[model samples]
Target chain A: MDRINVCIIGSGNWATTIARNVGRNVANSQHMEPIVYMYVYEEIVDGRKLTEIINTTHINVKYMPDFVLPTNIVAVDDVVKTARDADILIFAIPPTFVNSCCKTLLGKVKPTAHAVSLIKGFERGDDGQIVLISQIIMRQLKIPCSVLVGCNLAHEIANDNFVEGTIGCRDQKYFRLLQDIFKSATFRVVVTDDADCVEICSTLRNVIAFGAGCADGMELNENTKAGIIRRGFLETLQFVDVFYPGCRMATFFEACGISDLVTSCYANRNRKLAEAFVKTGQPLSELEHILIPGHEPLGPVTAELVHIMLEKKGLADKFPLFTVIYKICVGDQPLTRLVETLRFAREDM
Target chain B: MDRINVCIIGSGNWATTIARNVGRNVANSQHMEPIVYMYVYEEIVDGRKLTEIINTTHINVKYMPDFVLPTNIVAVDDVVKTARDADILIFAIPPTFVNSCCKTLLGKVKPTAHAVSLIKGFERGDDGQIVLISQIIMRQLKIPCSVLVGCNLAHEIANDNFVEGTIGCRDQKYFRLLQDIFKSATFRVVVTDDADCVEICSTLRNVIAFGAGCADGMELNENTKAGIIRRGFLETLQFVDVFYPGCRMATFFEACGISDLVTSCYANRNRKLAEAFVKTGQPLSELEHILIPGHEPLGPVTAELVHIMLEKKGLADKFPLFTVIYKICVGDQPLTRLVETLRFAREDM
Candidate 1:
């Protein structure tokens, strides 16, 4: 393999991480250094600020400090000139801005680039669709590019730390090529061909994160967290299985599925939203007003998605915990009272 | 299943739990009304103390108050004379005095009694002899009996809270017989014929508890603790697999193996040993000498046993962690340095 030039857009945490990990694989293959170009939006494009943020990250502090952008990293005031001839393009912007950003990039479309998405939230609009970032990219560019998404923790990746994640794309050659470019001593890359399962898993996990945040904000320990997370995965798999019968439910033994849910919900910023509710004794509406780009919406959206799916498929009886969380997040019910009622529901299971 | 009369020998935290869980079943079972007796060494034990000790103990406080010793319970002074014959007998005595205590009951031992043990320690002689509690019992009684042991927490059992435990015996009939008697809504009982695996798992766990406590005393968190526990399991299982081959390696996945190691090492009295060492700056040897009945020695003896077995078989390479721990504990080495070296050693594995 010759030198692989990797381009990352929206130079945020996850974006910085993929660049760092891919960049460190310089010596992994013969006669090659994966040269990574991070395109920072001019507003936050100060190279020093980017370096500070990247350096402050544990992943950078530990594994990929060398991959930190140089003082000469390109500050793109012009979007067209920024993505002129990218090879491996990535959309690492937040979901809300991704559609508009993709439109901005469509005019300067790098026709032959293979794209990967790192954005997390679902795009909400008039129809209120749970559109994935990859789908949005395809809609804008009129190109079928592969999607790569999984439980890639920013702190772990930034720390040059490795975590298990699935790199799923329909194109085997594209998947292997990406895997080889990203693989390092600590970083692990798992390949899969199921795009639907991968997308559903990536998007739906945030909903479970809402449930996990609720559990953690409540100070329920690992046992209760385990129960909640296990139920969430069951619901997730059940939903995904309807769309893709070949999807395998994660055995609780493999901490990846539930562990990922717990980390996103409790240890990360999403959990802080639920913690705010418990601490302030306020409701979700109040929270949404206060938290600009509030993490609370994932809860209601996930509850709605799971509820609509369960109701449509008539599988409500299978996941009692999901049903209760769905009711609590989206219904007219008081959470305190619902918690009291659902406490007994888990006793039988 | 018939309601079986169950009796525990100690008034310690664990003994009371066995009584409470079994007693509830006896009360509800149509076959027989259960009788639970806490053989308190102290007369008129304070219920408040018991409650404080067992925060949310499951058996009704009203049913068995501190002042009111149930008819089923006979004080130690009156146990030999007034105690009614029981179908199932549980010896929950402290392992330290088990031999002497069992010697007293030798003549009173019932032929049909199904005995179980909840102790997790080994006895060592001054000249360097090690004996397991069950081995002592077999030698004293001149008859074989079944035993149940594993990673069981007392507080949960006291409140009739659900937990997973292992039941092991040479005879499957005896193991299942004891299993049926203790099986209740809150208790999960898995019966196995491999006593050696159960013994190795239960004992080796305490040694890792010391390791965990040492880490916690030094201010480590989940990631570090988890790594030590995982490696420690491999170390313990190396010896266990040698002694008991048929026992599934996945048995380490049970609450007794990993979860118990985590809690006992980081959160319990076993871990508290590290606090004394760090706070007082007391030498471990001096501290161990002072706290003669230290539960700390439980794993040490098992460590020695493992070391001896490995040395004899020349299979020391199979378990590097065990070898390091055993050498550190017995040698005139600096405790802190030894612990630091172990943590570093684990990264390579």
Candidate 2:
């Protein structure tokens, strides 16, 4: 059999950082193809197209500035052109682009090609239900779509720091291929069959970051901050049990679960923005403009989305932290009294 | 039943800090007595007896200065005197004092009385086996002993910031009593039937804090820090499963398990000292003298104790993080390469 052709379907900072892992691992793997085709959205940076810059210089100069990607990795401008011949597709684009991108590649790519989405938030369906990005890809392209998520910070991974992550794949054959394609000395990969739990944990972590940021912004005790995080995790666990059932409790112990939540809570744009929102008494949008211009923090946005789903299901009170996060984001709840909010909110599970 | 008579053992900062919770809870509790007797080892603080200062001023001057304990918390220097008529004994003294203190209270307290140890470290039995402090209390005094552990930082609780804890009570009747004694608006109490896991989590948290502190000290990125804490918790989960079997994975989700670990990792003397050990090339004792002056950090000490037991049982390699921590403390392993140690150690179960 021919070696597995790998295609990375995004060129953002995370995508570029992960392309380093995927592109480099192909050098040593016997079962993976040598050339990795990375899809970079056509953009002009400094009078050069982004794809041309990445392909000629072996660096994602615009998204991931200084670090170099593997030499064998080729860059392509058209999404369909890059994905058409691949057997393993890695989706790391903004979650909003997943549906359209998958639609573009629907009949273009091999039906045997499976996907692993690194997208980190939920997309809403026409029925107003939350949909996993991998599900959208699988539904559009008729292929198995697993997910990869964990405490992997792009800059840290770029610097070659130790990182661990989980791959949620169901098939044993694909698991070994993925393990061979992504595992490196610094990047440890653990794969589980609970794909939905992996994606949900990645999505809900941003919401928990809001609570952790509020705790930090209020200068509440470490006890309260830790309690909010624990309670948020408990609520997420219950949310999985209620809506996305049949996942094991052990899945919550993986890198995609508690590790991702802890990393986001401690240090992330969302937590930082939430902290600024508390300290400056400004709306999240205003804080985003001032603190991190041009980029929006997703904590408050995800909070609103999760809140909408919970409210529609008539279970808003079931997740007090998530509800309170949305309330605080919208100024519906006074921030001053929330120093003890999660403490009194019955753990919300 | 008549109101439960309460005796608090030890009058250190934590003891005095917790006395505030016990004393305040009594005001709203019908099952508890109005007065609490706290044991204070005889000492002179600034020309006044420590017990006299607490009894007269409603404050523990040497231990918890400037904070007024509830007036109903009376202080006495005699251990047996405090325990003689009590029905709920709160043992918050240092672990070194547990054996002798329990021996003194043997056959002196009411036969119906029970214990709840606030100790955070392990005790070694005659065979060098690690023993829970509650086990020693029960063995010495022939009374049932439960435990209370969580992210309850003493100063934070004293300042009236929100706090949460778990009461590892096996008996439903005692659970209600403990729930009454520890619960407050700011002090939320969660009770679990798995007392042994709760106690083990409390004890092993110190060992994990060393890994966290080491990560921070080395200036490793947030991804690595979160990974270390997660791996440490994973090792602790496996540790519980091996020696103290039959505990649920759900118990580790409680305040005593992950919350306590997070709190200690982010902010505690053990974490602080471990960071200092990495920054300063001096020994732990030298760093303790410079930073904390009179008190010793327990993380390294507990690491050594746990290492001894694991070595005796031939399970040293099964806990890579714990073993590396002990090796780092004893200078058997270079601290530098540990940046990638746990990452490559196969998640040793």
Candidate 3:
């Protein structure tokens, strides 16, 4: 096999963290090149091009300010140029930008290149079906796409704190290669063959985190928070089974499943925003704007998508936790109904 | 078909909470008698018999102060008299006392009686086999046994905070009856048939909680703490499959499994002591003596039993988390090795 070239297709906090991991590994790895190209969507940072600042200072000052990127990681403003001749493509951009970014990479990347999506959340198709971010990348770029998901907080990963991530890939060879690129002493990786299950779990956990935040905002006890999370987990499994059957039950036990959900519920932007939504009686949009400026909070939006999908299948009633979160977000129901809805739903189950 | 007479075989905090639940429910339930008998090991409280004080004041002032027992619950000093003629028995005392309590009820209890164990630890047999507390009760009293386990912190349940518990019973008929006794609006119960799995999970969780506390005391980040918990859960499942095959995977999804484990790791006496052990370098015995006097911290002791059981089978290496916890508690290993042991163990897996 020829030496592999690696490219990260986003310049966000998570993307920067991935760059650090890959950049460090690729330096000594015989299978890949030392240089890692990160696609930077050219913005002005401190009176300089963001890409230039990243290249010169070896830092993603805008998104991940404190962490220093490895010197081997190069920044490219053009998506096509960044992805050109790359053997490994890592997609860590927001789901909203995946389509546009994939369009730029269309027919530019090598045919043999394999991709791993660090992107979470889903996109709505023309027929109103949920499309995973990885699916979009694979469809547009005509390449095999795997996914990585877990309880990883990007800052913690950047700081070299111990964490575990799950890689969901069908191809065992690619899975091993991806594991080599990402896994470190502190950043451990586990692989599974159920990509769809892992991706779906990653998307749905934001909604669960929203519910956990509501519990926190309402001053509900830890037991109630845990109950909501546990129920949310069961519902996530059920949703995957109903929509994407044949996924293994053990997949939900992986880092992509219960571990990620637990971390998001206890600590995350979604949980924080939802807690503020209940405590301040403010809209989620306003809180998102204040808490995480210029970023779309995925939980409420994903809840809306899930609500629509469940309704389309005439199974809205079966997913009360997701439905209640969607309703509360859209002002169709009061926030106070969150815990009661979950409790009653469990009884019905 | 007959009215069930209820008896509680302990007067500790948990037993008091169960008594309150049954006492309240039985009063309005046609299937059970309103009068509930509680076996109280005789003690002097404020110059009066503990049983007399409980009967007169409707409060277990010594064990569960600030919570009132239902007036219909009558306390008895004699264990045999408490067990006599009772159609339903609940064993909520510590495992150390289970043998003596069951010995007293050996032939005195009616054969028609059914029992559920709210006990949370294990006993070792002569040949070093691990024994479920329910097994002891069943062998001694000749009755069907079911188990209840979950994140029901007694104080939380007593305060009417919402929580869920799982009942594992193979007998569907007895399952429904036990649910009726335990379930309330705030304290919801879910039933499964994997009684042994549930019992094993309940017993092993204390050891996991100790590991979690060691992580906290070592000042590991939340992600690492969550990592330890997730690993502990996987080990729990593996332990059950190795020791008790034919247990359904879905059983771990129930409240008795994941929910209980999460609760114990986050907030419990064992976790607290283990945290202190790491922080102060004190033996578990001294810490338990100071922190929770008269109670053997079940996690360390359970770890010892699990270690013995696993060592007996020559499979001790398979469960590093359990082994390391037991070693730390027994002064065989240093406290600092806990996280590294868990991390390396995952790699080996």
Better of 1 and 3 by TM-score: 3
Error of 1 at B9 (Å): 2.1
Candidate achieving the largest DockQ:
2
Model 3 ranges with Cα > 4 A deviation: A346-349, B346-349
Give iRMSD, candidate 3.
Answer: 1.8
Clashes of each: 10, 0, 0
- List of chain B TM-scores, one per candidate: 0.76, 0.96, 0.96
* Model 2 lDDT tens row, A7-106: 9999988888888888888977787889999999999999999889988999888888889999988999989889999999999898888878977898
In candidate 2, position A292 carries an lDDT of 64
RMSD of model 3, in Å?
Answer: 1.8
Report how large a share of the reference interface contacts model 3 reproduces: 0.47
Candidate 2, TM-score vs. the true structure?
Answer: 0.96
Lowest summed lDDT window (length 10), candidate 1 chain B: B51-60
Question: In candidate 2, what are the lDDT values of residues B61-122, reduced to their tens digit?
Answer: 88788799999999988998998989999998878878888878889988888999988776
Fraction of true inter-chain Cα contacts (below 8 Å) kept per model?
0.00, 0.80, 0.47
**Which pairs clash inside model 3?**
none
- Model 1 CA deviation exceeding 4 Å by range: A17-34, A42-87, A95-266, A275-280, A288-314, A331-349, B1-3, B37-72, B77-84, B96-108, B121-153, B156-266, B269-294, B297-349
Clashing residue pairs found in predicted model 2: none
